[model samples]
Target: MDTTKIEKNFKKLTSSNKIFESVLMIGNASGDFNFTREYKRDIDTPMLMASTTKLLTTTCIYALVQEGKLNLKDELSNYLSKEEISGLHVFKGKEYTFELTIEHLLSQTSGLPDFYLTGTKPVFSKVKDRDFSYSFEEELEWIKHMKARFIPGTKRKAYYSDVNFDLLGKIIEAANASTLQEAYEKYIFSPLNLKHTYLANTESDFIPHTYYKDQRLYRPLFIRSCYASGGGVTTARELMIFIKAFWKGELFDKTFFSKQAQSNPLQMSFYPIHYMGGYMKITASYPFGKKYTLVGHSGSTGAFAFYCLEKDLFIVGDVSQIASPSTGVRLAMRTVLAAE
Candidate 1:
């Protein structure tokens, strides 16, 4: 890779002609090789992370496990299923189907319907009682109303649903006697000193109206993200600090870290990144052995941030210049992997 041209393009990408606002930060964990091109502002600004909150959900569950508050194998009903579920299967209308387990839920194998669509059922439903407002608890209730689409733990199809993390979030709170926000603050964000990163309960403080234009990536103007899971907000520097510490086995146990690596396999991969519980792992294939696991997740809703450990690097910013998840990584992968 031509670092010089990439650098030049980095500057061009931040230019107003190609973008309205931009921030790109790339650097190693050990205070090495820090570079940034940002016409928008500094690296400390906050951007919504979209689905990256899944990683936080995983860490929160891990904390519960550490505290002996949860066992992953326990059934969903054993812990947090508030609605009356006699078996794994609940009778909806007239159909009595199979059960949904907590393991299935965590592994994305529950066969539950996507909460984004079903949870937003009012948009598709005419029934009034079925109507539900957007909130953390309501999101969980939405999952309670769903039946497995297939036999739980059997189907492998990818269903990127916020309900997955929402369930995990519920697990954290139910086990800890607190909300997901509090649990996250206590177990993960606070202990690690991630003062800037937050699993937001509201967007009142941030996500203001702004104007930006970048052709390569899509980003929305100031708006609010519905309550579910994912869509967190944070800065690149804070994300990097978290990633570097997590990657080096300093923040978590070594044995668990290795298993965490195993949590992601080739099948779960989505090109530039692979899915592990909720976090996305990206390995650098272009430069041969420049493999890195991007410990954070990317949001389709205009925010992508990562803590890359292979390079001891953490890169957070909008590649599109506006408030959009950077398409740079995918664009790089496509250039190398796609056929002419």
Candidate 2:
């Protein structure tokens, strides 16, 4: 595919006003595209991937399932203590916490309140250093304080909860008998040959800094404890490789992938686009009224990766701006449309 128009549109995207850096990359099925341009940072720079880390965690879980080590229908009670999950899903005077399964967590159908945004609206603020740190135990205590939004497996309502993946992180460690970082390295990073992906357990100057409303955020403490959920940091190229593997079902069985694709009823998100099982399905009308649909995922930290099946196109990159996270999705759409 000719990328001249994509490159031109990327130029305009980076030219727009922003407080932090941006990156963009586009490729095809053979994975031949490695071209990159930076606005204020280098192509090698690594940045926080935010919720895109969910894709990694989910992929790892599926790998375990394919190995016959675990099943999606398995209950959380089998892996976690009843006391640990008590009052987690109190719906209509009934506590359905232990009934939650790995499937509910992966599809965001657990009805569990988000540990991060339970009561507060998103705010763009300034930061200087690593702000705070909390253990997974502490996060669970917080979740217990919050009320459940609905019963588990409601089918009509899916609430995106960090706690869901945080629990999954624990499950991964339990199943692998190792830390989430180690498990990822063994099953994913190493096998995929991803050179620049890691969980940011501590503040590092090497990781690209992010800004919200002109004020920098000290990498949150939760980033470390939430490694399987949203603590990962990576580059555009590495993310694209993962996306390609995801769509191609390289690490998991095709039947498992088919199950996930068919289980979008809970409505985890729209983002002005549709998403399921950590993947977004892009659909929109371009100039002259042509429409398209692509599948991939985006991070709230202005990161995006997607594959346009019809065009055999794969695009991945980030704006590295938290204040306008939606900017990354818009840029991806613009780039995809420009290719037409």
Q: In order, how many clashes per candidate?
A: 4, 1
Q: CA lDDT of each candidate?
A: 0.54, 0.74
Taking the tens digit of each residue's C-alpha lDDT, what string does model 1 give over 1-340?
2256556656655543645555666666567577665665567877555565666676667667767888767666666544533332343443322255555556665556665535546322321113223555554456666664555555334344566667666667788999777887886688788888776555354542223343332222112233326546677567666655555555445355555424423232244444554465565554564443455555543345566544445565554323333454542332223211
Clashing pairs in 2: 127-216
List, residue by residue over 43-100, the lDDT tens digit for candidate 2.
Answer: 5678788878888888888888877777889999888888887877877788888899
TM-score of each: 0.72, 0.89
RMSD (CA, Å), each prediction:
6.2, 2.8
Question: How much is the lDDT of residue 123 in candidate 2?
Answer: 15
- Compute the lDDT for candidate 2: 0.74
Provide the global lDDT of candidate 1 against the true structure. Answer: 0.54
Q: After superposition, how far is residue 249 of candidate 1 from its true place, in Å?
A: 3.5
Runs in model 1 deviating more than 4 A are 12-19, 82-102, 117-133, 137-149, 155-157, 202-204, 208-228, 260-273, 283-295, 307-310, 319-340
